[model samples]
Target: MSKKTLLSEIKEKIDQLVNAGFNNPTQIAKRIHRDLSIDETERTINHTRGTVKYHIHQSKKRKSNPALAQACQERGINFDNVGIAWNKDKHWSIQFRPSETGPTFEEMLQDHIDAIKNHNFKYEKIRRQNYSLPCLLVIDPADIHVGKLASSFETGEDYNTQIAVQRVKEGVDGILQKASGFNIEKIVFVAGNDILHIDTPKRVTTSGTPQDTDGMWYDNFLIAKRLYVDILDKLVKIADVHVMYNPSNHDYTNGFFLADAIKSWYRTCKNISFDVSIAHRKYFKYGTSLIGTTHGDGAKQQDLPLLMAQESKKMWSDTKHRYVYIHHIHHKVSKDYHGVTVEALRSPSSADSWHHRNGYQHSPKAIEGFVHSKDNGQIARFTHLF
Candidate 1:
């Protein structure tokens, strides 16, 4: 065999050894060195201990990611930011950031489309509402934190995924009953103000802060999804609905993905529209009103007015009344800037252990809604406190 062929054979043998539970680099090297020394033909390779160590490393890497190595070889591009975590079962978990030339944007987008299609969400068409009133209903179930856990013994309040879902349904029902007096033409459902307590299966937020969680990450996600779908179904019957997603810090990435999935779920519903992008702040225009929604973890309260004006310039200019609803403080604070009103809405989620220990349990739990007129600005505000 050629030298290249011999080297490939040696690598395959080392990989086989690795798969057979020979994970100790030093022991594997000694075994290979001894085997090669004993075999006269394989002795052509005078593999020193250092050479055996190199081969062992290469074998482990290849075992961890054979397809990735082959792809890199074919594309002539190396992957950076490689990481390996050793398992107790003598296996390695490999992770790496995608290479610069890994997948084109179109390819990634197509993959996402295929994934969405694979979900096979049952799509039902929503009938168009013919309400002739020029009024808008804004329902914001803020800071639900679906997976958060709080015990009555520790935090003086019991909160869990079940409580979180029940509160949203109850709050929305209350808001709808109160707003029954108004002639509504449109409904804006503000979503994703830390709707999830944890972003990862490790029971932590997106930024890696450990959390007091009540349920599994995926279970809570499904619970929140069902809650939103149920609420949107009700809202669409009353008026055309606009779902605005406010990306938050706790479940930032997961929240965006959930929002995207919701949008896909209602893709065929003509009465529902979606703003599910990853933008931290989202703006919606209603008649003479310009409303902004944000998670309130980013940017200073004082700066939101100018930021709103800059971000939604056309809406700011066209509307006579402007409001920015923010969450994450869990308390209520409303202030009118020079031309904009910034309101930090209250949350219905009870305090978890951290918040209760930190003395942040004073704020009353509530879900808020606002009613706006086409000619006038915000005419009514409703708070359903739990």
Candidate 2:
């Protein structure tokens, strides 16, 4: 056989041994002789050991004298090719096999670095466009049961109405700050249902009669309304405002009332639009996208997409991009469903703990937030805005 052909045959044999987990030199040499039908007398097993030891020693030597060992360990390294050294202190190392299966370590690392830089450039380019323009901050502040109490896991600190409100304020502030950085066209607010405590009268529950002051329901509604209005009024300074309201089952009777009151108040405010329609319906539209808000009470968890699609088809048949933002389960599920993207939002409520005892414990600890870009025809994109 020609020298080149013989060398190629030897390399293939070595690869087969490596893949079979026969790393020991003696066993590999014996297997090679058997497979190739070489004369056992002419082919000494010691020569095979020598070849394996030479390759291993070369790899170790590359760590110190890389210039001399590079040609033996790497491909395309003629005397004229440029040379590079190995970094021994790195946590991970990559070794090339004779099979030529994947890129060398240095090449892979360089590609990864270049990819990161490209991604960063794209993000910066997006940020530069529409710089300092007013942004339309769309937020779903759902299930903020003001009178609910949280356990140790929910809050490191003890649970109280005061603590819940404070925690929610932090989330609201984070969303506001993120939205402020973008060029906001308008701010759309969707207050999800279960905003207040509608526990049965004092004699019923195990928590020794839940607190319900005379104006507790009304006062809680006022508190949530005032907080929401104050935040929106501040955001409106940078952009126009639009509000969407959806009622939940827990407080559907009273929650709808509170939602109506806020909508009525917004009608009086200048430069702000309010849409207080029925629960579980498409209540807002932005460009080619139509948003449907629901408290997630009527349908099963797995049936959300079907429910939203059916609702969208009925409400606005010409809607290009359909989105359903629901709160109640307090878990975040973002995925494409039957050509539409469905999202189950996480809540800023302490009452989510009650769900755990009932065997539903996938809710997110941190509140969920999202930023929708009208520039792209996308329906919804979720983020932990807080």
Candidate 3:
């Protein structure tokens, strides 16, 4: 084969793999190497990982918008993300994000507007039912780690993006089924407690700690977004839902962005409310029961009771029963303090390389839920084990 033909074929292969979701250069290189074993082609181009990366960049540059690409080049900004959405109206929306330069305030606002416009959330107003035995149901699927990877051979349990999604759905269904006997007036869906495994494409946490990841960072973000949307959609049918966000160490920045995206998604819904702020601890009061939520990485467990009381002084004074649900340790620890009960929830994600190596194993992986009476505080606890 000719040298020109070999190079063209190499570029084609690279494009095909990238479109098929193998975005990493090393992954594409291995796949192409397995498919094409021609000696002449190997000698002509030598499709190493670096060569694959070059071809991928060239391909992306060719497909990018000329004016926008030029502006990014002038600003020394690298395109960090590219996405395509196909609407039911047969229209396509293409988007890309600049890593270094990022977007202006106006552009960010426009993106949020576009997100709402692209998809129609036909949410009809859900009527509230008068329940004789009213209670607040708290569904805290803590430490999901949606993009974390764990091989059964290494960690004694297999985990990936698919497993993470499945386990959450099953766990939520299980909790709802268990709580079906009670009249659920309101739901506090605890979100953003390390829902994503990584914050950056470099396979690292927000603080730059390296991690073993499963899917691409963007894919995991979308997966978590869809998961939250689906859960909220279902919860709203049963009762009025309140989404509480708890910013965690891992995926701290991305987690906030995800919560905002979810907030935008359900902007039209009347039955769902959100507390997607960047607060380290979030408090919600239902009747005489006041519940606090935190990711629990920064503040110590013993100090949580005083912090809750200090932070939400009005709620603390008004409510008779108080509880703070915390996550991050992936194990169970419950302590009743002077006026509050601080409980660290369990996680559904299995141990990855770091956790497995450090002897963090066998803590009964499960998703937990709590049923709180109007004046009696937390009455029932639901556990869905893996």
Models 1 onward score TM values of: 0.69, 0.55, 0.74
lDDT of every predicted structure (CA atoms): 0.80, 0.57, 0.84
Query: How many collisions per candidate?
Result: 0, 10, 0
Q: C-alpha displacement of 317 in model 3, angstroms?
A: 0.9
In the range 97-211, model 1's lDDT, one tens digit per residue, is 3222222334334434644554555546656546566689999999999999999999888999999999999999999999999888889999998999988767899999999
Worst 10 residues of 2 by lDDT: 120-129
In model 2, the runs with Cα more than 4 Å from the true position are: 1-135, 151-157, 199-215, 301-319, 351-363, 378-386
Per-residue alpha-carbon lDDT of candidate 3 for residues 213-256, written as tens digits (9 for 90 to 100): 99777668768988998898889999999999999999899899
For each of the candidates, the C-alpha root-mean-square deviation to the true structure, in angstroms, is 15.6, 26.1, 13.6
Model 3's alpha-carbon lDDT is 0.84
Q: After superposition, how far is residue 65 of candidate 2 from its true place, in Å?
A: 97
Q: Estimate the TM-score for candidate 2.
A: 0.55
Residue-by-residue lDDT tens digits, candidate 2, 1-386: 56466445665787677777765555666677777776656556656545654443343444555544455446655422323434344586544322111233343334334323333222111112254433345777777776665566753324445665676777767777655556666667777466765533231122333443322343454466666656665656666667777766656555665566555555545666776666565456665566767777776656766666665564345556666777777767766766566777877654335444565653554555555556454533334432
Best by lDDT: 3
Model 1 earns a TM-score of 0.69
